[model samples]
Target: MSPPDRKEAEVRRMLDGPHPLVPPGLGLRAAVRGRRLLLWRRRLGLAGWLLFLAAVAFTVWAVTQQPWIPPPSRTTPPLEGW
Candidate 1:
């Protein structure tokens, strides 16, 4: 049979049969794991924000400086002598 059909048959067999008992304190273990994962995710998010802000600041400074553009003339009085 195909992989999907095989998987469906296995699921059907499992649903028709009785389930095994949970070991003890499953909820407590799951809660502790979830809390640790949450804290890890928050720290990663803070670091990502700091990097993003630094890039934006660097871009702003580079564009505003515009060292390549020539400075404007103080007085425009260049007429053709020919």
Candidate 2:
């Protein structure tokens, strides 16, 4: 049989067997864990967005300020033949 057919037959055979017993609290535990995972994911997403905004703000400041260029001279040069 083809690989797909073999996989389907194997799945059917497994389904025909008796199911295993699950713990009574499994669903409750799973729900709690799922909620925690969602909260953690949301926190991480917010942190990522905050970081991205900070980077964008820094870039804008850098572009506008042009920190790489030196500032203008504070004093005038010596007057020639005063």
**CA lDDT of every candidate:** 0.93, 0.97
**Model 2 — which ten-residue stretch has the worst lDDT?**
1-10
TM-score of each: 0.56, 0.73
**Candidate 1 residue-wise lDDT, 1-82, digit = tens:** 5467888899999999999999899999999999999999999999999999999998898799887788898998888896
lDDT of 1: 0.93
- Over 4 Å off in model 1, which ranges? 1-16, 66-82
- Clash number for every model? 0, 0
Question: Residue 9 in candidate 1 has what lDDT?
Answer: 92
Per-prediction RMSD in angstroms? 7.7, 3.8
Report lDDT (Cα) of residue 22, candidate 2. Answer: 100
